[model samples]
Target: MSTQTPPPVATGAGLAPLVELRGIEVVYDAAILGVADISLTVAPGEIVALLGANGAGKSTTLKATSGLLVADRALVSRGSVLFRGEDITGVAPNLLATRGIVHVLEGRHVFGHLTVEENLRTGTFLRRLGRRETERDLDEIYGYFPRLRTKRKTPAGLTSGGEQQMLAIGRALLTRPELVLLDEPSMGLAPIIVEEIFEIIAGLNRTKGTTFLVAEQNIAVSLRHAHRGYVLDGGKVVLTATAADLRERDDLHEIYLGLASV
Candidate 1:
């Protein structure tokens, strides 16, 4: 195990991490290795980025944390996943969501046939809020993504790619999660839209105190919005540092491409 301690970010210093992965190893179909050994931490109210190229196990790590691996026929074969210091390895994803963790998957997933407002209602099922409370929450989400409000009556499938992405995130917010595991949030979006999405992510972290563990290939934008980051290569963590420190490393692109050592 590595003896290094992660540099602290956010006001939750000295408190137990909101999420912790201790040398976790994931396997798919009980044979194929997904991640060899990966560990990291997310302090409450911090935005931490998981940076890597395609197939670098970024999504696998997020699935492990969110307990969504079972959907992919995957499991944490070794080590542990902790939420606020409580062991929760292999817990059901729905159970995890009720425990204040939610995952926005790599692809912008939405109910194509449902109107935008109807789709957001799905998020309130776990909480079982009354009609008034549900409406208030819906308003809050629309406040975050005004575009969603404009398209509230439109089918999610009719929305643009960026609008769909925003809707996915907005719906997740109605769940009132303490920790959000966001995978490839920038994928397939235009650069301007990516920037807009990340800005909202940062704003949520700042105002709502929502802790985030974001898996992304867009290192530049991820680092710009995140407080700290972990860089993965070939299914293992190769670098962990504060965002500023990582941004200053000129060889970061090379490191991502496997052309240089950390």
Candidate 2:
């Protein structure tokens, strides 16, 4: 990793950020660089987006933050990842979940054989909630994704792509995460379904005070819901701005269309 410090963005609005990654670099197979010199922050109850196209390093950044890098033959070679004021870089993925850092990976990896409700139940494995609390949490999840309630008894693999995405996010909610790392939530879904998923994310941030750092390729939809967004290209952050500022900038079109390099 380079010794040069990353440029600063907004942080600590009278409280520590829910997630902070400072000058982080990741490598795979000891040769290939995944992401380099990445720095960003997510305030409590805020929705942040890592916006980029395919091969733009969005997923690599999310994987580093959630400690899933090693499983992919990658490692955080430099910098730090902090959650709720504690350094958690290189922590095991399962241990990170128990600490309220939940990651909903790309492709909505729900268990195909498990029933819808059972998939949700797997999220509660980290927390020692009693039957009553667990049931209450399940009810709340159904309240958020009513479609899942109707399909509770059905196998997850039989659900539509939109429903599978909902199941992935709902299962993460079952962990009661303080900060959620979501990768590509809008991929391969209809525009209407993407809007619905984003609405649920906004509701969760508004009512539940859950912090989100979402990696997405859908620039239009991601900006609509994000409080702030970082535009990444070739594994480096090209722009960081409030969602409103990013929306108003014309130059971002080049970045999104892969016509510009930072």
User: Cα lDDT of all candidates, in order?
Assistant: 0.90, 0.87
Question: How do the residues 57-116 of candidate 1 rate in per-residue lDDT, one tens digit apiece?
Answer: 999999999999999999999999999889999999999999999999889898899999
Residue 148 in candidate 1, Cα distance off native in Å: 0.5
- Which predicted model would earn the best TM-score? 1
TM-score, per-candidate, Cα-based: 0.95, 0.92
Candidate maximizing lDDT: 1
Regions of model 1 farther than 4 Å from truth: 1-9
lDDT of 2 at 211: 85
Residue-wise C-alpha lDDT for candidate 2, range 75-100, written one tens digit per residue: 99989999888999999988998888
Candidate 2 off by > 4 Å: 1-14
Worst ten-residue run, lDDT, model 2?
A: 1-10
